[model samples]
Target chain A: MSDFMEQFAELRDQKRFQDIVDAIPYARLMGVELGEDESGELLFSLPFHERNVGNTVLPALHGGLIGGFLENAAMIHLIWNRESLDTPKIVDFSLDYLRSGRPKTLYASCEITKQGKRVAHVLIEAWQEDRSKPVAVARAHFLLATTS
Target chain B: MIATPVNPKVFEPMGQLFVSLPHCATLGFQYLGADGRKPVLKVDWREDLVGNPATGVVHGGIITSLVDTTSAVAVTAHLERFETIATLDLRIDYLKAATPGKAIYCRAECYRLASQVAFTRAVCYHDNPDDPIAHGVATFMRESSPLPMLQEPKA
Candidate 1:
């Protein structure tokens, strides 16, 4: 536990979130990035890539990637502010598709709805150009870091 | 809605269309045609698909993608025609982490088809259905999508 605590503190000193994101292959594959919003709150964004296109006619982003991005967003937020050294695991994820994901930049943010010793709940919303018109919304339960 | 008859002939071809999809192709999804009347899909393991570099376990989201894609494609089995559909909602339960270095297989069933919606259930496993890695149930809004991905392949 002390070793993991040391590692966590060392990460907090440097580019913590970005370094963690870099280690995740799918997050890298989908071009998930962490940056500050206009108000300087940490935000995750999926940058446009041609391969990310799920619907060629409408030229829309793939539903899978949209779902993946939201899941990744929640995981990253939890990792960035995790209270335990153990890594969190997703238990279940549910998503609602409000509109077609445009083939452009998509942004997502997460809120920890409830936190407990062994589990946590998170709600996420993703939008394209307009924050008011979210393209997708999701909620998930994660098994928080547990002693190995 | 095109009142097309239930034709078994389109099953294989429809599966082919899904595999050729840009996203599916990019992820290397293989459309394994109906086996014993149940359509199965597979995606081989790739280093690029690894999520936890420490353990080489694939990302949880990949399972979601597989289940969602399979559940969506499974609707054609019931309708017996390739129609534009949109995923209205999906829930994935991660039963366990998938074994690394093994391809993942999925089986999905569209049990009910209402006028405008389809209900589906899917399972993702490595070698045995009895021990699934994740289970999912997804609902698709039929005829709502305008995607041109399903242009009628000339029979």
Candidate 2:
């Protein structure tokens, strides 16, 4: 297995999911926190920061960061329950901005629509306050390939 | 939301202002002026932006941000007057991983503008325009709060 997978396997076995996320700088930089539902399904939350503002007029969240949140959430969902070392490669990401996200903390949840042998499609929704009124909805396709 | 740009000539200042916005500046996007008729933008590689730690490739989200922002700039450049253009949707295809230390650049064009929508396509590349790390197409809804003079007269 690759060195990354080995390290991931090691840390994943010994700690909670947040600990593993804390070990990754990318997640830390985004300031995302992980939580679970009543059923123990993972959910991602992005804390509000001043630098996250995109337009100064209505003061909305950057669309890109919202995309980043969704993308990362899907990836985290994929790896949370797996022992395989294969890191899922993002193929494509498509998102619709349903409404302008207010300057508030954002949350995302991923549902894997289809998980094939070598490819997976995940659907993600992000909202700021009300989950029913999602600010953005996205679907991503990932290539699941083993690294030597 | 953004104040309306009076004319296409303001594209330069508008592009700069777009990047100077809190989020864009935080990500280190530099407005490179226009390449012919299209608007160009740049983002330097940074450590915290690295997505795949194993390969040290920049995050795909960085490219998405670049494309989406650049596409909005393209509309600002293409329009006679600009207002709060909302990004209705954006689709990005990850073609290749960006090398860790390379500053990526983007060029985008607003291909079509209708009564209610603006269409744009963009490509992000490290060195050559033909060689892209990612390509994206997006649409912006023209939510124009037109002045009384600019509004359509009674038909």
Q: What docking class should model 1 receive?
A: medium
lDDT string for model 2 (A59-98, tens) is 7788887888788888878776666788888999999999
**True interface contacts reproduced, per candidate:** 0.76, 0.63
Best by DockQ: 1
**lDDT (10s digit) by residue, model 2, range B18-124:** 89878788889999987655889999998888777778788787888899899988887766644667789999999977888999999998888788899999999
Model 2 alpha-carbon miss at residue B45, Å: 0.7
Tens digit of lDDT per residue, candidate 1, span A43-143? Answer: 99888888777777777888877888999888777766775666778999999999998888999998888989889899999999999999999999998
Q: On a 0 to 100 scale, what is the lDDT of residue B152 in model 2?
A: 28
TM-score of 2: 0.90
Question: Candidate 1 deviates by what RMSD?
Answer: 3.5
- Each candidate structure's count of clashing pairs: 0, 0
Q: State the lDDT at B91 in candidate 1.
A: 92
How close is chain B to the truth by TM-score, in each candidate? Answer: 0.88, 0.86
